[model samples]
Target: MVARDYGQYDGITQALELVGERWALLIVRDLLVGPRRYGELAAGLPRIPSNILAARLKELQAAGVIRRAPRSRIVLYELTPYGRELEPVVLAFGAWGFKALGDPRAEQIITPDSMTISLRTAFRPQVAAELPATAYGARFGGDDLLIRVQGPELAVTRGDGPADLAFASGPGIHRLISGELTPEAAIDAGVVEVLDGPRILLTRFATTFHLAA
Candidate 1:
């Protein structure tokens, strides 16, 4: 742990002392989806130094926020139940931050975890309720994700499986969700392709979730 102490009294200060370190909450963000090996975490957080990543992992482990277990001869880091309690906190942060997001800089990149988390944070239950149950398979940045919407519930998982619709671009997905680009526009631009399933599902998928403009 870093040497700075925020004091033992206030809960907010204590919480920050545990997770306020740079890149720490982001590490938690990536892990919220599922367990990840060190390399996977490193890949998700492309900019974090290996040593810093190791240090953050150690700190989280010591705080009982995460735990390490052997998986197929490799160790996987996952959140403890106590750590999982921060889901709402992370999602709220994402929702609040969405309004500040402008176009990405040239050096910025999007990862699958980031995409998945955005979907979670921006889900609009009232809008989703109007759509029929559906699933979409999305492939972007060489990653496959399964997006499912059932009534008012929406979920995004990392994997490619049976889906009612499929798409293959990250920015296209982002644009669709943020209402920056319509589905038809994305298709016309050839930024997104429907590899399988009905085109209407793609339309519904685009309309089901939204972010604040």
Candidate 2:
């Protein structure tokens, strides 16, 4: 059971009662990208205690926000259709919080999932429309992601795949997205390495994402 009861008469209170638990919404955020095995969820949220993660999963599953499906021999945890409906809410929250973002501490880490979500929150479709369709492979630590921008839509998928451009480093990309560092600055500082793909694509990528002013 959840730790607190908020009376639950008003709709706002009811919703908060259902999702206000710490880490609950974060689980939803991670699953927003796609289904994940327990280990994958844990890896994406490295700081969450194992017991807490299990408990949150159980709570979300009980609330009909998530479901378990057997994939081959392993079970994957995925958001239900109802849970997927939270996309707008999550994205809105991310956008609202973008202005509050500041420099990271030395101990803080950026996970691949968070980076992908940031892209979703900060992507500029108007700017994207000015660029050609391109796929980017991003390597963050040991994780690999495929980021495809076609027309005005952007899709981010985990795992490696063929791409027109490829780059590595999480924080550097974050800096570029947040407009804290320009693409040329990041490259000059040797923070973002272009493993392959056209050099101009990097400039387009930098232009295609910007945090709210």
Candidate 3:
């Protein structure tokens, strides 16, 4: 049960009472990427107050949304099956929120987990199904992600390696994802830089993963 309960016994109200608190769903978002130690969670959500993180975690655990487990001699917080079911909700919410995203604020930093979920949200599995297998090393600010696309499968993991294309971009990548800029235009405007590999793959990258703005 949530720490607070509304007078009404509605389902949506109950759901909100459980995981609707500030920072709670974001915690679930990172956990969707994978399990993480408490410190790792804090590092991902840098602005979350320490006490708030602890309290949210405890509340989520109590609500059966998450649980703590020992991993490699360290405690890790991970989602339970019920929590995993929130993946689709997060992806849809992310795509819906993308419409309102303008230029990022100066202090807004993109973490690997945020980028991972965003990529998943924007991925065009049907379009990618027709493209050749491709790998990309993507850099968003100080974060690095290895993206592999084969048919309808898409995987974004932390690291960089041999890829069909490697590109670096900050928040301007959003423009590309939102179709505000084409691949060629993005490169010309210096919104995206080719780090390595053939530049043509950048066009494929844009086609394979995009959200209609």
Candidate 4:
């Protein structure tokens, strides 16, 4: 925690003091995906100043929000159980913020971690519950994600695979998710390019993952 104190004896204030600094929550967000080396964290948050990153890491470690551990003989930063409790809060926050998310700014870029969270926030398990099992290969910029839907279960992992539908898209995929465009419209408008897969599966993909504007 930082030296600055809010002097409030409340849960929200205390929580903010622990992880309220700029770039602090983003660190936690990435860790929510998995443990990461110092270099990997820095790479994921390329805009964070090195000094600030180091300071936030130390503070989070001191606050019991995160800890350094050896993984495969290499040290990595991961969230503690207490920190993991913020997952639901983070998901809610993302979903709420997404409602106001407009078009992407020129400089805005999507990292794999951010994309993973986006998909999670947009996924509608209820709709997927009645759908057949399907897998989608999604690529945004250079990041690739394998999204699997089995009944109401959804998993998004990084890497390639023999997916039932493989498609490449940019920020415009948000249109499909927001219901602004149907699957066929997205394809015709070139918002999403079918890389390899049955075109019909794209409709299933739309049915599986979506978020209302």
Compare the candidates by TM-score and give the number of the best one. 3
Estimate every model's Cα lDDT from 0 to 1.
Answer: 0.85, 0.84, 0.92, 0.89
C-alpha positional error of residue 91 in candidate 4 after TM-score superposition, expressed in Å? 0.5
Write down the RMSD of all candidates, one decimal each: 2.2, 2.0, 1.0, 1.4
lDDT of 3 by residue, 126-187 (tens): 99999999999999888889999999999999988878899999878899998899999999
Error of 1 at 90 (Å): 0.5
Q: Which pairs of residues collide in model 4?
A: none
Give lDDT: candidate 4, residue 79: 99
What TM-score, computed on C-alpha atoms, does each candidate reach? 0.88, 0.89, 0.97, 0.94
Pairs in steric clash, model 1: none
- Model 2 misplaced stretches (Cα beyond 4 Å): none
Per-residue alpha-carbon lDDT of candidate 2 for residues 1-213, written as tens digits (9 for 90 to 100): 554687668877766766778898889999998889999999889899999999989988887889999989999999999899889999889888877767666777778788788889888888888788989999987889899999899999888899998998755466777767778788877778899988678888888878854
Worst 10 residues of 2 by lDDT: 170-179
Q: Give me candidate 2's TM-score against the actual structure.
A: 0.89
Runs with alpha carbons beyond 4 Å of true place in candidate 1: 6-9, 189-191
- Using lDDT as the measure, the top candidate is 3
- Judge candidate 4 at residue 198 and give its lDDT: 89
**Can you list the residue pairs that collide in candidate 3?**
none
